[model samples]
Target chain A: MTIGIVGAGALGLYYGALLQRAGHEVRFLLRRDFDAITRNGLRVTSPNGDFHLARVLGFRETHHMGQVDLVLVGLKTFANHHLPELVAPLLGPETRILTLQNGLGNEELLAANFDAARVLGGIAFLCSNRGEPGVVHHLDQGRIRLGEFTGGLSAYADSLAATFRQAGIPCEAVADLPKARWEKLVWNIPFNGLCALTGLTTDRLLALPATRDQVRAIMEEVITAANAQELSAPITTEFAARMITLTTAMGAYRPSMMIDRAEGRPLELEAIYALPLARAAEHGVAMTRVAMLHALLEAGEA
Target chain B: MTIGIVGAGALGLYYGALLQRAGHEVRFLLRRDFDAITRNGLRVTSPNGDFHLARVLGFRETHHMGQVDLVLVGLKTFANHHLPELVAPLLGPETRILTLQNGLGNEELLAANFDAARVLGGIAFLCSNRGEPGVVHHLDQGRIRLGEFTGGLSAYADSLAATFRQAGIPCEAVADLPKARWEKLVWNIPFNGLCALTGLTTDRLLALPATRDQVRAIMEEVITAANAQELSAPITTEFAARMITLTTAMGAYRPSMMIDRAEGRPLELEAIYALPLARAAEHGVAMTRVAMLHALLEAGEA
Candidate 1:
């Protein structure tokens, strides 16, 4: 399968390298890393194993990539405004677009530009970072939860998941996209937001009892919000506890939002925090903790 | 009048200078600033006027200072654990103690050490900072609200307020101490916490509409919590608006908590954020915004 990876950041490079290694033609749309990637290819250092692609196709402009069978968007959600123009040149009539961006409204943004049926939503459960210009570090967990934005399993999503699974990336297809987003949010909103706001790692946050309770409170608020939105994905107190345990086991991981903040980049506040908060507000679910965190992040950005 | 000024930071020095100028014998109990203050006296650069005392008394050890008519406690609330020993040397049977620190439970801490009847509460509505050792910059506003801890007017409180007023500091005596603390908190919890957490000054925070709304929301939460605790100081929506307008006029003032954080000093989280939050929780008022902010501040301190 020929695939085009947009926004060649850490996740884009990690997944593109794996897909390319799996015999799929994966082309990366580059920006600042264009020269480095084109000259040295992409190098991925993962706990699973290290792989270096010495020769790979890279493009500075989207128009040069032509059409592909699938377009995997790994851009920060803050850059989604450029999608209509960037993704236009790479889309065929049946070119399925899978957005692996963090937060709530990426698929909707893509669906507004491309076909709704071809716009798939995905949550990357991978701990990864771009170490250098063309190097990706996969710390742990390389799972992708994929689903249709409008709900239910799609043939394209299933096939893509199967391909990802074949590449040793545990990809799961879900029937409910909103539910999946909320479930991801149950973890994302608390961990990512707190890490960015406090500049603390996952282990540090879980180490303190007060902060641990705060994380649980934030997760419960997300679950209440999801239930209020009528999206049922078994998000419960037990699930929240499981998330805490899981993060505790992840050792000392710095979340993506924290990395964005550390690198002086704009946070994915609109998609990750504001969108879900607005939905929750519409359903009369007062996510005060999340709202305060969102406000602080927004203030910091300003 | 004999006055012993404990905690020779900005507020302590500013008030001490004014009291000395007003013909009261004011002695400062210092720590790191002991030598500078004793050698050079205390220099206050104020918008109102510049004044420097060349022969002020300073003591490194609390025991070196004899008992006085009044002991003005101006230490950061985080250092209140050493209050019993520090204030013991300066307290007589009727050496009325007035705590001029920020946040709730300060009067209670003083009351625990000294006589409950002699423990007075004060809210300093002054913008001041220690520019250097023995040097304080008085930016604006030198009014203080004075009240009794047990909640009523007393001769000691009245005389203290009169003394402060005579020293060119506008001091008002109030009947309800807890109400005064809550009223001050309606401003402190939001502005101080937000400024410290976001690293944004007053003007920047007020400049953005979203953050401005957040400030208001936080103030409202404090008001709710205050009302829940049965302390009614007329902290209404109108009062909150007045506070916002007042802060807007203050330009780009950095609250004390922000200054403490900038100087790498531990924040007074226990008194300022935790005590009030615990009280609100016991009263069944969910101060979720303040609680989250408190947690973030606590984490940052950790």
Candidate 2:
């Protein structure tokens, strides 16, 4: 199957390289490095070693993007406002769109821009960031969970999962993807928000007893609101502890929100923290810590 | 009257120089800069002008500090741990110690280290920092509030106020000093903690609307806890707005806590934030923002 990866950032490059290595025709749509990649090729630095593709289709202009069997959307949530422009040329009659981005409301954006039948709900659990132009760094890898919002697995999703598995990337096709998405949301709103607002890494934050208790408290507020919305799962203290361990295991990888803050880039503050806080408020749950975290970020030095 | 100033940071030098200029003998107990002052002199730079005092007494050895009529304890709260060692050499039959430090529980530490009759509560509303080895930059000038910690003003308090007034330094001798201390605390815990954790200046922080609301929430929590402790003065939203205006009026001054965090000095996190949090917990008042502020400081990257 031929695949087209939109927004050739870390996640897009990782998916493109892995699928191309599995003997699938993969093309990357990038705005910045298209001319360079069209000349030299796409470069990826992974734990396995550096992988370079000498012959890959690089689309600089969206109009140059041809038909594709699948399109993996990997842009940051801030780029969602431009999704229609990005996916315009790639959406063939049978192309399925799989969005593996962080935060909520992206699927709605995609569905509004494209056909709902072509939209797939996905939760990506990978530690990846752009190392440089046309170069991607895969930090610690995790699986991607994909499902249909209408609650059924499509043949195209199974085929994509098979290709991912063959390429040594973990892929699961779940029947209920909301739980997975909400679980990731619960973990992120506390850990990423706290880390970004305080500029502390996961291990040091968890080391302080006061910070650890706050991590749990913020998560509890999220869990309470999640339970109220009937999208509840077991987001316990153990879950928070495990997340801290997992983040530490990623080896000094700063969360994307922190990275944005460190670079003075506009953060995903509203999408990740404020949206959840608003949701909690709607449910009548007191999200004191989460609200304060939003306020801190909105008032951030960056 | 002879005066001894302990922990001669900026405030101590400002007041000591003022007292000396008013024809009173003043001395500073110095450790790091005694040789410099003995070789040259103490220099004070203010908006008005710069002045030098060549006859200022500089004592490196605590044993050299004989009894004085009054002792001005103008140290940071973190340095108050050495109260017992520092106060021993300055104590006499008529000696009284006035504390002009930020934060709570310094009086308790001083009272525990000295006789109750000799310990007086005080707060300095000035903004100055150490400029050089023998110089202090008086950033902004403000009055001092001094009174008995146990209750009611005594002769020592009246004389201290008079001495400050005569030196062209404003002061108010109050019947209750703890109330004044707690009022200052409501401003410090939120603004200082937010600045320290976020590394932003006071004006920049208050300029952000969300941060302003967060600081207001913190003040409300503090006022609730203060009221729970039977203190009548409430830190209302208007009071928070007044503080925001005051902090903005001070220009781009970074909180001392941020400076300490940057230099890896032991933070007065406990004395400034944790003490009130503990009190709030004891009173069963929900200190939501204060609790989160404390958590953020504990999670500070520095």
Candidate 3:
């Protein structure tokens, strides 16, 4: 199956290279010249040595991205405001688009921009960072879960999973995708928000017992809000704690939000932190920690 | 009467100039070549134009400041750790040392280093900043409150107030120093800590509604802690609100603690913030906002 990847970031590159290695035609709608790929092709440097894959097609815009079987949107949450312009050129008659972005409100965004039936709810568990234009540093936890939205399981997802598995990338087709999305959110909102606001890495933040407790409290608030919205996943309170422990175990890894802050860019504070608190408040759940943390971040902004 | 002015920062220079302008023999125990004084003497540019006072007797070491009548320690709180060395040359049978530093532990530290009878608690109402070394820009509110440790009044206190009044600096000699100290603490401990940790100026921080409420809650906690310690001031809850209003009324200014942080120097976190919370906990008073603010500051440190 041919695949078109939107937003040639670390995630897009990781998936693009893996699928292309599995003998699928993969193309990237890149923002800039991924010269490293144009020169030496894409490189995936992971804990399991380096995997050099060649001849991954790259496009500077969506206009050049021809018809494909699938499109994956991997842009940052703030960059998703222009989704219509990016997703329009890649949507063929039955071309499915899978969104694996962070924060809430992203799937609704994709659904609003594309046909709901042709959009898949997916979440990527890979920890990757853009080392350079065409170089991606892959860390632990590389898995992708994709499923259909309210429709029966389709052969497109199955073929994509098979292609990914053949290329040594873990892939799965879950029957329920919203739960997976919310489960990923439970970990993202709090830890990312706190790390970004405090400008500390995960281990450095958790090393301070007070901030560690704060991280735990924020996760509980997210969980409460998710449960109140009647959206939860297989991730229990125990699983959330273990996820935090995993990041703490990683040691010295800076959250992406911190990277944005260090680069003097506006953060995803509204989407990742404040919106969940607003959702919790809508359900009349007392989320004072969320409220106070929001206020602290606001104060820092001032 | 001969006087020694230690710490030669903005507060010390302003008060030293005022005392010298009032016909008191003032000697500043500062380094020999402080920039502003060395180049242009001490220039205090205020509402009444500039007063270039060149009467300050500057010394590089405490040994040159032989047996003075009053020793005014106007150093920053972090500089108070070396009080024994700074106070050595000014100690005499009749010398009274005044401390105009912020935070709670300074008085105790001074008492531990010197005789309590010679230590007078002082709170300066002046808003001054160092435009350059030895040059103090006095904005407004140049009032000073002086009170002795003992219940009995002293002639030296009255003499000091008379000198200040003659030099156009407002001052009052209050009988209850502890009350005045606690009242100042109610404002300083919270607002200063918040500004230092968040890097927000006074006007900007109090401009936000949530931050304003946080400041009010912190003041309430500090006052409650003071009452628990049996050192409550005459200021009521309404008066504390009035104090916050007054702080915002005073222009945009970052406290010394903030200046320290901007300069990448070690903060007075223990004295200004942490010790007060520890005292509140020891006194069995609930300091929710104070504790939260301290936690946020500690998180920022990490």
Candidate 4:
């Protein structure tokens, strides 16, 4: 199977490397790391195991990448505005586009440009960061929760999940995409927002009782908003507690948005904060805590 | 009239200088500024006029200040934990303790330590900062809205207002202190909290549409929270508009909390953010935006 990886950041490189190692033909659409990866290939250091792709296909422009069986978008949601054009050259009639980007609305953005049926949403439950230009450090939990943007289980999704499973990455195909997105937000809105705003790592945020309570409150608000939207998933009040326990075990992991903020990069505000907020507002769901977090993060960006 | 000034910061020195110039005996309870103020006297550069007290009374220990007819508590709300002991020796039976601090619960904190009748709350509608150890740069609007904490008119309030008016500083004695604090919060919560979190000035905040809307949203939430507590002032929806207009005219003003955060000083989160949030929560008022701001500011402190 031919797979094209867009925005070869940590998430892209990690999964791309894994798939390539599993004997799939994977090409990384690169930006700043183009020359580094092209010269030295991609190197991944993971708790699971260290893997190095000594030589691989890389592209600075999408026009030359051509159409593939699948295209996995790993771009920061802030950069998704360029997606319609960037992903245009990589789509065939049956080529499915899977986005593992954090936040809401990425699949819609993709659906707006490409075929709605071709755009799939997946939430990456992983802690990883780019160690250098061509290097990715995968901390823990490399599972992909896959779903169809418009809902239901599709054979393409099953095949994709199968591919991920074959590559030794856990994958679960979910029925309701919106619900899955909201479920991801139950954790994202608070952890990502607080980590970025406070400049605290996951463990440090959980360690402080004040911040820990705030995190729980934000998560509850997200769940409430999700229910208000009638987007049902496995999310519950217990999800907050579960997140704390999971993140505590994840150690001092810096979430993607936090890393983006620290490195003076554009944040995924639209996907992670704004779109969910808009949905919640539309449903008359009161998410005051998340609203404040959204405002602060927005102000920080400004 | 014998006046004792607690917390000898910018607000303290500014008013103390004015009162001293008005032919009143003013003694400043100094801490780190003791040596400089004692050696150089209190120097104030104000838009109204430049004033220099060639020699002034300064005390390192509150015991040396003795009892006075008026005690101006000009400390930051975060520093009010020391109020009970700091203002102890400076109080007489008739001593009126006026706290010209920003935010809620300041008067309550004072009442907890000193006599309830003796505590007054004043909102300093002025822009000033400590230029140096002994120097205060008064930018504009030196008027103070004075009110008795327990409410209603009092002789001490009248005298204090008269003294301020005589000193060329406009002073209005308000009927309701709690209401006035809430009214001040209509302006304080959004401006101070945003400026502190975003590191943006008043003009910069208003310059961007997104942040400007956020500022307005936060102000509305504050007003909602205030009304929830039954502490009503003249803060209508128009109050947010009025504040924007007023702050726009004030040009680029770095609010006190912003300066404190930038200078690595502890933020007045309890007084400005937390207490109001608790009140709003108690009343079942949904102040999501303010709650988020409170969380962000609190986390920033952590």
lDDT of each: 0.88, 0.78, 0.75, 0.86
Which ranges of candidate 3 are over 4 A from the true structure? Answer: A34-40, A115-119, A122-125, A144-167, A171-186, A220-228, A231-237, A286-302, B32-40, B146-163, B173-191, B198-200, B206-244, B284-302
lDDT of each residue in B1-302, candidate 2, tens digit only = 88898878778888888889889988788877787777788898888677888878989755698988888887777777686788778888978888887878877888887788778888878877777688878888567988897778788788888989998888988887867777788778887788888778888777788777787778877877877775535546577667767888898887778777877877778778888888878889878878878877766634
What is the per-residue lDDT of model 1 for residues A1-302, given as tens digits with 9 covering 90 to 100?
A: 99999988889999999999999999899988888989998899988989899998999988999999999999888888897798989988879888999898888888887788888888888899988798889999878999988788878778878999998899989888888888899999999989998899999988887788899999999999998886645577888888888889899999999999999999999888999999999999988788878878888986
List runs of model 2 lying over 4 Å from the truth: A31-54, A132-135, A149-159, A230-245, A248-251, B31-36, B47-51, B232-238
Pull out the clashing pairs in model 1.
Answer: none
What range of 10 consecutive residues in model 3 chain A has the weakest lDDT sum? A227-236
Error of 1 at B56 (Å): 1.1
Q: What is candidate 4's lDDT per residue for B10-76, written digit by digit as tens?
A: 8888988999999999999988878988998888998778889988899998888899988888888
Per-residue lDDT tens digits for candidate 2, residues A1-302, read: 88888877778888888888878898888777777777887778778677888877887756677888888888778777888888878777888888888877777787887788788878878877777566778877758888875566677677767778889889988766666676677778877777777777767777788887887787777777766664525446576567667766775667778777777777776567767677777878878788888877777744
lDDT of 4: 0.86
Backbone clashes in candidate 3 total 0
CAPRI classification of candidate 1: medium
Scanning candidate 4 chain B in windows of ten residues, the lowest lDDT window is B226-235
Angstrom error of the Cα, residue B278, model 2: value is 2.0
What's the candidate order when arranged by decreasing lDDT?
A: 1, 4, 2, 3
* lDDT by residue (tens digit), candidate 3, B102-210: 7667767777888877788788877777775667888878788887766446887777777678878788788777777778888787777778767788887788887
